[model samples]
Target chain A: MSTAIALHAPIEAASRAARSAPAADAARADAMEATLRALVDAVPTATLLFDADQQVRYANPAARVLARLCAPDKADRPLAVVGDWHPELLNSGALHLCSMHGSWSGEVILGVGRGQHKILLLHLSRVGADLFGMTVRDITQDSMRESELHARNAELEVAYAKLQGAQEQVMQSEKLASIGQLAAGVAHEINNPIGYVNSNLSTLQRYISQLFSAIQSYEAALAGGAGATEAESIRRKLDLDFLVGDVPQLLSESREGIDRVCKIVRDLKDFARKERSEDWIKADIHRGLDSTLNIIWNELKYKAQIVKTFGELPPVECLPSELNQVFMNVLMNAGQAIRDQGIITVTTSVAGERVRVDIGDDGEGIPPDVLPRVFDPFFTTKPVGSGTGLGLAISYGIVSKHHGTIEVSSTPGQGTLLRIELPIAQPR
Target chain B: MYRILLVDDEPNILSALRRCLASIDVGELDGEALKVEAFTSPEQALERSEEQDFDLVVSDYRMPGMDGVEFLSAMMELQPAVPRMICSGYADRDAIIAAVNEVQLARFIGKPWVDEELAAAVVALLRPGSARARAPKALRAQAASARITRVEQDDDGAIVLRSDDPA
Candidate 1:
């Protein structure tokens, strides 16, 4: 309020002095107007004033510069009309708003020439009775910076999506590489059943032909009224009794062989099926273990005997296929740990709300120095080119993803025990 | 009579071998009949080998306690003159090299052996002046004295061969 009173005292004094000497007052008024024009002209904002007839009364230096760029034809002709340079102001009705409210301010994008454009902040106000003043501030550079920021943000979103796709691809390739490592063992397992089954079929065919020859001989003996002695000789020579007794056994054994091959294939499919969405469902842990064992049985059969001590288990919420992969990796390691015959004991039990699976091998155990690094990727005790070294590491990752913990305990030259603990239900 | 020893871990394979050998006529073996003594375990087969002599021995390459090469190597120690062969479903290169170098294998017949080829291979092994035929007559007589008592089935449904030798 004191500053307002100080400003009012100057104006009141000037007016009082003007009333005393009209000629001197006119000279002073002209000097004051010149000072105001110099101040407005120095500002970066383009300033303009209009008279009651809506004609340009004053144009500051900035305003004149704008006129030169925007309307070169009217550059020296004087800004006779406000609409000539700022047509948007008339179209936006901001001038009508200013007449009613005494002031208006907004941002406007104005086309200059040759399809070029500039952003301007326009402020219009009534300076005196029937007189108006306006200011325009160029703000095109500020808007350009904001749009560049938005474009950069969109690029970042695309990059993030690509990274997610790459991560999933890595997971898939790792699974396939693990299978390729086990392909030899699986092939051997299937070959065994197929070999016997194929042999069995050939033997069956020979035996059937022999039986058929015996039947033909008997028919001839009966039709020609030959003595029964000839028929007995034919039976003994053809070994009909042996064929009758062994045919059923051969068929059953061949069927069993085919069934085993089918089971191995089914188990492999169960273990290797891709979970595209990584969907979690309530699944039986025993089934996963059993199927995994079936798939890797060839790797273990020659080296170790598997012993199972399964306890009652509730349906645990988990990814069945990924968990099976973990089982296969651990079991394969257990098999490789044994140089000769040994025992691989698999035990599962529930303690409180956690389900525990323990896979123990009575094989050449890990030494103290190598025990801690077992879960590290590319760590292998086997000779190079025989092991991928990712078995245990991948298992660790899978178990951790299930919100579980895998712990290993070992004694040098005794054995290694891998124990996994998982919650019965996943936390929401 | 020609005594042939067949060993494999899978009982189905043993049965298939037996059936296949049964189809070979006595005429195919120089008028001599074949008596196959098949075992699922190499250790038991080795124990049986100690009591009696076999004309020819065919064993699967992979087994639980002992592989074919190891069993044949041990067999060579007991009976140096007996002819040994390996019949395996998986022909592992290392095992084949070991069989050739260590056991002096008579033949390496793959599993799912063609009836004619396997029979022909066996006939060639048991021909006159072959390893089995070149054995001393006294050893053959001694093998004839040991009698097979009875076939027993174990808990796992494997056939167990029992033999008795008169003192």
Candidate 2:
């Protein structure tokens, strides 16, 4: 009997221990809930918890402020109750992005009271089996900055276009002005010779007509029973024999002079023909150099001796007139650099797909520091009136347009060398 | 005698023309002797032209004050019957057009003029049948209309006409 009572007492003790353990577990759960609530309320950013149906279950102070901003009256209501809130948050099994707030997974917006527009970033995360936690932050300044950057980029593009247009206009005007100057010089030089040649021819024609009439008179007199002595006397008086012999020679000389003048005029016409728009063509570099030399011959002939070293070069595709301008500028500069009796050498060769041209002058070379900025617009070593400072700049632009390059090497006392490399064919 | 006035800017040209004209022997021919007077300046030539009626006038295209066309036009207004010719080295299309339209030039002689060609051109101008023909009033009006159309076509075609002055 004592053994049975001992066993029953142990069973009763086990039951009481079991009942006390459940009460301890319930107290622990309550303490955990209070700690979670305190943590949520203390956070800086807006934090909220929602049930599976998207109803707001708990909101910290920060979360209450955000809720009022996003949906004032719907702070404790289901998310769907807010008119502006995205319904996709409730429908989408996974988190959905809010485009208005620029957030990957939440419904965030400016508060109704703050009538001014603002930006907000929000994130929604699943917490438990039937709960979601959302965090929100304001980001109005960031969006505004992005918009301002876009506007600045557009303005910069417009300014760049205007700068490019102005540059092109200046280049074109410089080219035209140079051509006009050349044309004036050429016309003046050509007109002087033409004036005398015309007068000489006109006078020679009259003399010829008179001589023919005189010759016919002498023949008639000889036929009309005039004696040999009388005829001889008449011939000597009229200087008929001298006229007969010299008139034909004079005519021949006049004809030769006219032919020479005609040739020069024709050459002038051909050289000064109006150029078409810039277009690439297969051009012989040597021929182009020769033409440029002819055009600028008057300027260089007295100052320099030109030497040519032409190799078997392939034709290059380029704008012929533009290339001619470059040649003229370089050649003229070379001539001007010489004090007196200097040598200008032009050499050409072909390597692979490139045609290389070298123009070297035995004149004072460019200073080392100035060489670097030679292609800069309005940079000139020459006197102000003598140069517009656009020659090298224009040449550089022309070379670049042709998909070519120009380089210079110079020693102050020795000379300067300008090297140009142009592609034999245009790149596709 | 057909009196001709030859004007040039250069003294050498005037002297050469005088020598060549003085050497002519046209005594036996029924045609009158060609009398030539040379002047070194267009201004002097114009002065001489006002003093005497010249049968024909030849002038250089380029001069100091007035161009050949302008000088010739002035001469034409003074003596409408006188034939005018332009001898020039810079005889481009624009100059030629101006010569034809402005002065009604009788002939254009390119510089370093051949002796026979010059004589022929002068003879052609002096011929009785070659007297300046007064175009009908209607034809003159048509010419004006044609010039306008020509300019319009040139503008539409985007053709850049050469400048009037060769210089």
Candidate 3:
């Protein structure tokens, strides 16, 4: 603002001098012209003035340098026509547009010399009737920098997309690694029932064959007219009464074993199912918890007893398998915290529009210092190879994705409790 | 009577073991009929063991309250001369070593044990002055080979073999 006022000070002085005396007007005009010429000549922008006949009236020092570079052959001669300095500008019709519209501005390429060109920004304006003013600036380096920046941005976007893809793949591979770890406990769970059922089946086969042999002996006695006492002796010898009573018991036990095995298989199938796009379903939380418990029961059964105090719950809209993974992680941690016989209690309740699940374990509790960092990725208190440490971190992510919260409270040497609260219905 | 104590967390396992021992007679057991008492809880079995002496004790390795090794270690205090056996589907090497070195466990019986092998192990443990060798491997090789062929047909069996906890 101050610079504009200072530039107008000379012009104002000239105008005021003209009013004071007519005798000094010619001397003041020449002084004003010299001051204006020096100001225009000092600026880097090329400045040109033109008369109504389309002939160059004056060129600033910067404009003369540009004319010399544009047309070296005509450098010695006075620049009278616009085409001699820049044929592109003369062909652009900017002068005609400025005469009609009062002003025009554009960017153009000016061929300097020797097959090279410079990008130029041009501003043309009509000063008064039959007079025109124009300014030009070279912007070749600035435009090159802008294009280079654009290319770099595009490359960064592609790299960012690939990084996101790799992150998703890592999450999936971690899930698979956890499944491999659980396979040992699951195999133990299944093998127990299989063990008992196989043993019972073998015993039952022997008992049946014995009963069949007793029948054959009785048939022979009846067909050959043997004494009644002989058949009775044979029945007692075969322990027919014991076989009759125990066969049904064995059959029932075997049936229960097979049922338990089938349930384990189904729970495993549910646990290991691949995530799908349309995997969201309204599911019973209790059922998912029960199945997850069944899968990890082998790991927990020896050290802890599970106590479930489940209240009435409405169906929760969720990804069932992912939530199952969360439960498995928390429950497994609860089981591992115990050094001996302990109690793991899982309680659920609904308060307003949210459902709350609290898993508490009476075990060796977490230390106060380590409690806060439990959810950090790759943080572990367990021995190496026993845990990947992604369990709680992944659970935190899953719960957050459901727009829910998970918190833990622990008293050293007493127990630890983990509480998860989730909205019953997801927001659309 | 030759009193045998059986401990397993699963009721079905106890019942199956009882059936496998049902045919033992006085002649086979050196003039005494085999009397089997089964308990699902190791603590309860230990309480019972305190009340009466047992000729032999066979227990599952994994159980609530006390594992088979601990239970047998306590049983050794009650009846120092009695032999103890551990039966389990899980094959934790450290637990096995502890059972052998600390408890002086007489036998390690794998689950889905052949009925004849179980009966033989029990009889051998009970017999007077019998050389306390490991459970006899009479039908083990044949049975194991047969089971391996069927492992793929049974998904759990395949997993049991593939798992790091190998028997």
Clashes of each: 0, 2, 0
Go through the candidates in order and give the C-alpha RMSD of each one to the true structure: 11.3, 15.1, 8.3
Decreasing DockQ order of the candidates: 3, 1, 2
Q: Please give the range of 10 consecutive residues that has the lowest summed lDDT in model 3 chain A.
A: A1-10
What value does the lDDT take at residue B112 in candidate 3? 67
Best by lDDT: 3
Task: Summarize candidate 1's per-residue lDDT along A74-123 as a digit string, tens digits.
Answer: 66654566776655643437777888899999988877767888877889
Please give, for residues A1-428, the per-residue lDDT of candidate 3 as tens digits: 11111123334446666677776775768687668868887877887776556577656677777777777767766566666577775544777898899999988887777787777788988876777777877777787788888999899999998987775666666677677777766766677788889888888889979988998999999999999899989989998888899989889989998998899889888887777736788889999899898888867887888999999999998988888888988998898889888999999999899899999999999999999999999999989987888889989988988889999999988999999988899889
Q: What is the C-alpha lDDT of each candidate?
A: 0.76, 0.66, 0.78
TM-score of each: 0.72, 0.50, 0.72
Model 1 chain A is weakest, by summed lDDT over 10 consecutive residues, at A1-10
Q: How many backbone clashes does candidate 1 have?
A: 0
Better of 2 and 3 by lDDT: 3
The Cα error of candidate 1 at residue B44, in Å, is 1.4
Better by lDDT, candidate 2 or 1: 1
